[model samples]
Target: MKWSIVFLLISVQVFSQKIIWSDQQKLEWSNFKSKVKTMRNPDVVAYTHCGWEYSSTVSSDPSVPVKIKITTIFREDKSWKDPKRINDYALLHEQKHFDIAEIYARKLRKEVMEHIKTSSDYNKNFKIIYNRILNEYKDFQIAYDRDTQNGMNKEKQAQYNASIAEALETTK
Candidate 1:
């Protein structure tokens, strides 16, 4: 009987907590890591929506691999069974940007610093592209949130749509 009360309290707390990562999330993270490794970007450690911050930078050395930290969302009224559809997609999307940036950086590194003493151009160009990517992603996210609102089972249709929209945006 005592154990049952404890179980009840724990269940209540859990249910009250916000949804975050799922089993599928772990697999998704692993797959993302695998794909990113292929991209050969050393500075990015991990990508995640939930973490110490939305995104951050890390140091790298020959002795240590650069890592990006990813975090999951905090407890909210939303369902944990269905996390944001765009969560992983967003990470992958950002990873691609990082890869592009790394490529651009590498190319720039090959040139003499005297040729372009300022990092302003690269920062500006990257910001424009990044904003466009994020904007389109947001549009998809809005559509998805709307689509998933009517489901009884809380299926992540919004997440699915967001993922698709992000992919299309990237490809374009």
Candidate 2:
């Protein structure tokens, strides 16, 4: 018997060089490949673009199980830093942002697994969950920058760094 599989991918529209999040790999100054642009707020020294994407595959045969893959990615081409102002502290802050994206990607994977077991409408439910998680992830990123004062507040930056490290440990 020949079994068929259907694949569905959901992701942002950007087509750029991306690096998958990995525990063994950490972000470096070289990873920030985009040309630095003047921002409205001159205090902004760097930007890190990180996010998650997922794809689902369903087999035609009943015996074959459905599979879902979630990936956390760093957009190298879309991230940038001001060379004159960049430092280790600022790099740590940016790394935390990427770490947060990985945490959310794991959360989405868990949700998809649980959801697939219970929901009959996989695609619709998956989209809903994906959107909700994406929104939450974006909000958290904004809050991180705000609470840390864009890494200028050393104390808050340390707190966020610790929090993100703990989350990364527990989520995996």
Candidate 3:
């Protein structure tokens, strides 16, 4: 009986963590897709679900090109109700991802050449920098998560600011 109860509880929690993007998330993601269309000239899509925060590109067909997937956290909180703020957050963070992807699109050939010539440490450092960039973006996500729990709007905005600062510093 105890084991069954625990299983049910876990299942409830897992089901609760679902993607339910607000209209604001959709609008922001739509704008993001428009911008990326010009920048990447490829297919783009954004998905938001509770308890998950990430994005990627995938190729479903051999002849078809890769498509973008901007997955973000979908919290059941008041922050998402505020279209302006959440839109701002989504735009900023997803743009960073898009910008990084665009950089890779342009430099993949060069990076591959450099990766072949450089020491393992160089490749490791490159990965570290890439991770730093991602972390810089996630700083906003952390703030959003915290805000959703505490209703700290200012703190959430500050997270975006900090993320931008950290991203700039990492690039340098």
Candidate 4:
């Protein structure tokens, strides 16, 4: 869980159909054409299944120090839209959800690096750190929807977008 990754998308391997997040790669309305869950509430407008994937390896050194890497993925197939609410503004809101995931990933990366560099036991602390950050990420995602009223508040949505972008840069 103590990752010391160099930079963004260092390895371009196709882990799956997941589209790794990027500023250049904005999600289009066409990307929202996937079918929605039938059992879900009809009132819901859209869903963005943004998530993170992590991998770890211990160094060859005797200590077997752990190295963890976390990457966020926007699960396009799992995500869906109501079709009626599909618009630039709605898509922007969805994009912010993905961007928010990146913010947490960056924060997680920074924490793991600092922990590995300073702590005596990296492996033991990895899970604690990972779980803590993961919890925070989930909370923030919910708070985002609540505060912005599911992207109805353009002002709040813009603020969240700015905060996410700034968090990403500072963590880098």
- The best candidate by TM-score is 2
lDDT of 3 by residue, 58-124 (tens): 3343333332233334433212222333445544544443333323322332333343233443434
- Candidates ranked by lDDT: 2, 4, 3, 1
State which candidate has the highest lDDT. Answer: 2
Cα lDDT of all candidates, in order?
0.36, 0.83, 0.39, 0.77
Pairs of colliding residues, candidate 1: 18-75, 18-76, 45-67, 45-68, 46-68, 50-71, 85-159
TM-score of each candidate? 0.28, 0.83, 0.25, 0.80
Off by over 4 Å in 1: 1-24, 27-120, 150-172
Predicted candidate 1 versus true structure: per-residue lDDT over 77-132, tens digit per residue? 21111222335544444333332232333333333222222344333343454455
Of candidate 3, the 10-residue stretch with the lowest lDDT total is: 35-44
Residue 108 miss distance in model 2 (angstroms): 0.5
The per-residue C-alpha lDDT of model 1 at residue 83 equals: 23
TM-score of candidate 2 on Cα atoms, chains taken together: 0.83
Q: RMSD to native for every prediction? A: 16.5, 6.5, 16.2, 6.3
| Per-residue accuracy of model 4 over 1-172 as CA lDDT, tens digit each | 2242533334443434467888789876566545856326554578888878888776546365566778888876678888766678888888888888988988888888878642245656878988999999999999998888888888998898888778778766
The candidates, ranked best first by TM-score, are 2, 4, 1, 3
Output the better candidate (1/3) by TM-score: 1
